[model samples]
Target chain A: MRFYAVAVYGFLYLPIAIIALFSFSAGRSASSMDGFSTGWYVRALSNPFVMEALWTSLKVAFFSAVLATVSGTMAALALTGMKGRLRAIFDVLVMIAVMIPGVVIGIAALIALATAFSAINPWLEVVLGRQLSMGLGTLIGLHGMFTMSLVVLLVRGRLETFDRAQIEASNDLGASPLGTFLQVTLPQIAPAILAGFLLAFTFSFDDFIMAFFVAGSETTLPIYIFSSIRRGVTPEINAIGTMVMVASLTLLIIAQILLRTGTLRAKG
Target chain B: MAITQARARALLLTPAGLWYAALLLFPLAVVLIFSFGERNPIGGYAPGFTLEQYANLPARFAAFRNTLTLAPLGTVAALLIAYPLAYYLAIKVSVRWKTTLLILVIVPFWTSILIRSYAWIYLLGGNGIPALLEAFGLGELRLINTPFAVLVGIVYGYLPLMVFPIYVALEKLDKSLLEAASDLGAPPWRSFLQITLPMSMPGVMTGSMLVFILLTGEFLIPAILGGGKVFFVGNALVDLFLQSRNWAFGSAVAVALIVIMLIVVALYTRAVRRFGVRRDDVGLM
Candidate 1:
């Protein structure tokens, strides 16, 4: 068992170790490890397209995270107060949203967005003097839609354990609903909110399929990585991939720490 | 006063309900509507209704065939590889080492799969693993762009997903039960088969479902590792929608995929519940 476990760890890290090792290689072919150099990293960073995609990913994740948090927090609260059949339907809907293949979602969104734009094309042309279609906004909306469930699950789990008396006390002192939520509920569940945002951001940043469909010509990081891989393998992509791996791992570590020690949970 | 209470509840639901409907339901409705329509000559859907798209399903039979077989095979492969590691961590590791090791398991999981798959591309490429094998007099072996490579990539990408759930189940198991089983004439292996494996059924089911479901939709591994020769439904759908721009046929495929996903998930839930092991908290992806 000990040997097997060590072997499993080796398997997990083997490719990662290789990629990191090769990213510093002076050679272009990833299979060959030549003299070490930082040329690939410089090339990856200097590439304007890589920078653009990175910026787009960050912007999309930030916006989607905020939207998902707000909507999900509200939904979680509403779900708690819901009764019987309505709550069951909402529950199933959320499950379906997550369970359905992302490709299905992507196609549906693509078709839907195209149809929507066609219907509004005349109006759009009248207003903006051109037809509009899917872009970063659509990507953000899709990410927010799919990731809302994670927020609901996290925030609702926290809310279930939350003390009701504190909220009642705020209400007992004649606080408005907004006031009561802000003063009593929000602060207590802030950690769950933070965790949800982080999860949403992670999903958004790492997303590829849905982004691939809706992102139009404005490439996001995953799409860019994918297209580059398709066009031809490059050592510079390995460098970029290494940097992305490091960044996401760092975010996840921060998320684990936040969720583990804070009100939200790392484990289910 | 009663109206006010109802109104407050309605207000709270408005944003989420709207978001769900516009994003999920509306798109779903559009796809369903398009599934019955015809594909236009210029690409995308036309207004005419027909069952031709459903009948045309067999056109991508190879993709569906590959998906059905590989998804389960990949799940089993992941399960076989992950079980022992999860067992070691949960049952054998010291408390101090457990945290660091588990974190290591997850850090890679959170990294972009694109990066991970890219790594595999090079490893399985000409001068990578094959070269190593050549050094050992194994002859020049072809690993890249094969089903073997796809399976390896699948197992590698999903190992952590399979591990964590099993680890959680094993971690929470009653050691006293195992000890009691062992206190009797039964050996450690027997005790494990009876107590540990049966008790960890939820994790196994959850992990298998999560991996299997995702694997069914996967295109990236096949695209990168299989070199576009090996295809799944996801790859087919990507081509139908993006390349062909065949919206009606794409919608039909999309609807079929959803139905298949729903049926499989439902069947899995029923099977799990039929066994009286309903552990829904598999830490949903």
Candidate 2:
């Protein structure tokens, strides 16, 4: 059993380890090691296309995280007071958002947006003298709405065990509702909110499946890498992959810590 | 001026409600509508409604067949491998290392699955494991671009999703029940079968459903690892929309996939409910 456990861990990490190791390979091919050098990493960083995609990814991830955090926090707070079937319907909707395959989401969103664009573009051309298309805004909207479920789940879970005494005490002390919310409720849920935001960012940044369909000539990092990979993975691709992995893993670790600390703080 | 609870709720839920209505519900409705529409001569959708797309479902029967066969195979394979690892982590590992181990299991998942799948291409490619085998005088063997390679990718990619839920379930198990069983002359394996297995069924079911559903729509793994040979509904959808520009047919495929997913989810919910476990206990993350 112990050996099996170790083997599973090895199986999990081996490919990742290979990617990281080969990122520094002096060789051109991804398949073989040709001694160690940081050339690929250097080249990958300096590459114009890689940098643009990375910047685009950073922008998309940041905006989407903010959007998801705010909307999901609000939804979580709102649903806490509700009871019965209405809440159930919303809960199922959230679950379905998470449950539906990314491909299905991508296709559905693509077709729907295309339809909407066709209907709305003629008016936009006459009125605003511009056209609507799938791009960063669409990416942000899709990622934000999809990841809102994560934020809702985390915040709602936190809300369920939240110490209501703090709010009640503040109210009894003649504090205004908004004042009480800012001073009491916000502080209590801040960690969860941060964690949710970080997770949303990580997911958006790492996402390719949904972005693939809707990116519409605007390349995010994963989309860029996917195109590069289709041309066959080189050592440079490995370097870019390594850099992305490091960035996302850091975000994920921070989010995990925040979630744990939030739980502990709630318990205390 | 204090607002009513109803007003506050409305204020809070409005953004999310509108977002879902427009993006989630509306898009899904479009998909349903398109599924019944006809493909234009140049591809994409046409105005006239027809069941021709539905009638054309047999064109991708092989994709559906491969997915149905391999998805369960991958899920069960993942479950089998994940169970022991989750057990070891929950029951055997010391508290000091458990968190580290758990986090390690999740670290790979933070990276783009595309990158991870790319790594497998190197490992399973001819110059990889096969070359090593040839060096050992075991003759040549081909691993890459096969169903086996795709299965390995699925199992490897989804292990953490399978592990964490089962780990949570096992960790939350009342050890006293196992202890009580052991004290009453039941062996460890027997106790596991009678007590732990039933207790962890929810986790097993949750993990299986998650992986199975994802596998049903999985294209990237098969595209990269299966080399486009082991077609899936997801790949078919991708080709239809992006490559062929057949939006109407793609919508039909998407609709069919959704129906299959809904059926699986409904069955899973029924099974979980029959076991008398609260849905909340099945933590996704």
Candidate 3:
């Protein structure tokens, strides 16, 4: 059992270790390990394109995470008050979104966006204006769409264990629906909200496919890394990848810590 | 307390409901509509309705075949490896080390799978692992740009996803059940097969479903590690949408993929539920 455990761990970590090691290797060839230096990191930081892509990725992730969290929290709250078939329907819909391939969603959005355009009917044009082709806005919108389902699933689990009585008490005290939600509900589910936020951010940050379709000329880090790899391996890519790995891992660890501290209580 | 709260709940739900409807449902409806429509000769969609694209689905049969074949094989390989590790983490590890070990399992998940797969490209490339193998008189061996390379990358990329769910399921399992099995004179392996494995079925089902579904649509590992030689439906979709700019055909493919996924998910859910029901019935008997 221990052997198996160690072997699995090795499988998981070895690739990452190799990536990290190669990031610092002085050699340009991905296959050759020619010794280590921090030169790649320096080059990665100094390169204007890499910096721009990094900034773009962070900006996209921030907006996507925020929007996803808000919508996901709303969905979760609605789910808690739902019962029977409605709840079942919502559950299935959320799962379907989760299970649907990113490639399918990306292409569907592109098709839908393109179709909405060029058809000049007033309603069609209005919808097209909203979709308005794939760009940074569309990329963020798609990221939020793909990630909101997971947020709903996670936050809903938190809300399931939430004490309804507290909301009732707040309501009985003459708090408005919005006020009770602001003062009572938000505090209770904040950890799930944070978890949802971080998870969505990580997902959006690492996302490539949907971003690839919608980003137009804007380069998110993953898309940049992807194109770089396609053009053949580079030490600069390793540097960028290493940075992304460190940042994402740090955020994930923090999220796990928050979750384990009982900050986000799982109601179910 | 009840009726007014229900009304408040409905009010709160309005924003999210409208958002989902407008963004998610509406786009999906558009795709469904376009899938049934004719493709304009140049590009995009034509007003006239037809299922010509669906009829042309056989054009990408190779993509579908590759996906179907690889997805299950990847799932099984991941499961075969994940189960024992999960078992060890859940049953054998001391409380002091379990948290650390579990964290280790998840640590890789923090990195982008794209970067991770890229690393595999190099290691399995000409100068990395194969070179090392050749040093020991194994001779020159090509590991990269093959189905086996893709499998290795897939298993590596998805192992944490497979492990965590199963680990959570096993961790939540009651230890006393294993003790009871042992007291009944079942050997360790027998106890595992009879008690442990049966009880962990939920996790197994969930993890396998998660990995299987994702693997079916995977593009990155195949594109990178398989050197674009291993065509998948996902790669086809990417090409149709991004490279070819064929929205109409892409929509058709997307709809087809969704239909296939829905069927698989339905069958899987039914099978799992039946297994659960039968297990419960046996317990009652």
Best by TM-score: 2
Candidate 3 lDDT for residue A184: 90
Evaluated at residue A187, the lDDT of candidate 1 is 76
Every candidate's DockQ is 0.72, 0.81, 0.66
What would the per-residue lDDT of candidate 1 be over residues A1-268, giving only the tens digit for each residue? Answer: 8888888889989988888888899987766778999999999999999999999999999999999999998888888757778689789888878887787888888898889989999998999899887888899899999999889988888888877877889988999978998888887778878888988998899988889889988899999999998887778888988888888777777777776765533232
Interface RMSD of each: 1.3, 1.0, 1.6
Better of 2 and 3 by DockQ: 2
Who is ahead in TM-score, 2 or 3?
2
Candidate order by decreasing TM-score:
2, 1, 3
Backbone N/Cα/C clashes per model: 0, 0, 1
What is the TM-score of each predicted model, taking all chains together? 0.94, 0.96, 0.93
After superposition, candidate 2 runs with Cα above 4 Å error: B1-3, B277-285
Candidate 1: C-alpha RMSD after superposition? 3.4
Stretches of model 1 off by over 4 angstroms after superposition: A127-130, A169-176, A264-268, B1-5, B277-285
Q: Model 2 misses residue A102 by how many Å? A: 0.9
Local accuracy by lDDT, each model: 0.86, 0.89, 0.82
Better candidate by DockQ, 1 or 3: 1
What is model 1's interface RMSD? 1.3
Model 2, A209: alpha-carbon shift in Å? 1.4
lDDT of 2 by residue, B195-246 (tens): 8887888889888999999899897899889888888899999989988998
